[model samples]
Target: MIALSDTVSASSDLLSTEIDGEVVMMDMEAGRYLYLDRIGSVIWSELKRPQTVADLCQSLADRYAAPIEQIECDVLDLLQQMRRNDLIRLHD
Candidate 1:
């Protein structure tokens, strides 16, 4: 399971591009394409460098008006999905 203390970063194996304010990524190893909305794109950009889950939530909370708890939940869900797709790596 992912925790707020865990560090996350984008996988080095992805080739991604931005279009129409969204992001499209291709996982080279998996040969799969993934789409990310604006918010997801923001998260992806932030993951260029490893960031703690708590730091990610705090960053999102600053940029968005959502509550910290909601941001945390949403970030966790998205990160989980990203992990499953091999788009991100987690470092405990």
Candidate 2:
């Protein structure tokens, strides 16, 4: 399981493109395509550089003017989905 202390980054192998404030990514290895909304796109952009999950939640909370707890919950869910899709890499 992923923890807030863990570091995460986008998988470098994906082929992605941005359009209308959203992002579309192709996981070639998985033979699948994924679409991200504006908020997801922001998260995806930030994940271009590896960062701790706690830090990412704080940053997003600030940007979206939301509570850290809520942000953390949403981010954790999204991160898990991304991980399952092999769209992200996690570090201890």
Candidate 3:
């Protein structure tokens, strides 16, 4: 699934996330939370859009001037890691 999780509602626990920014955790499970860089932040925003992977990759490629194939690979790897870390959830 290219999309992060359109049906998986965003948790309020994650204060906010932005490109070139970070994800704040008010009630963090573990203190000193994980941080994301500019590229990760961009992917987070695209996922926030509730867009499918296809759309997200296309958008990322366009925004960053990268090849779609490369972006797709990045997205898959990052998303899998995020999912494993419970940083994100898939719709199903």
TM-score of each: 0.95, 0.96, 0.71
lDDT of 2 by residue, 1-92 (tens): 78899999999999999999999998898798899999999999999999999999989988888889989989999999999888999886
Write out the backbone clash pairs for model 3. 2-53, 3-53
Q: Which stretches of candidate 1 lie above 4 Å from their native place?
A: none
Which runs in model 3 stand beyond 4 Å of their true positions?
1-13, 17-27
For 1-92, candidate 3 gives per-residue lDDT tens digits of 43532333233345554433755433366454666777877676666644466777777888887788888889878877766656665564
lDDT of 3: 0.62
Stretches of candidate 2 off by over 4 Å are none
Alpha carbon lDDT at 42, candidate 2: 95
Candidate 1, residue 91: Cα displacement in angstroms equals 1.8
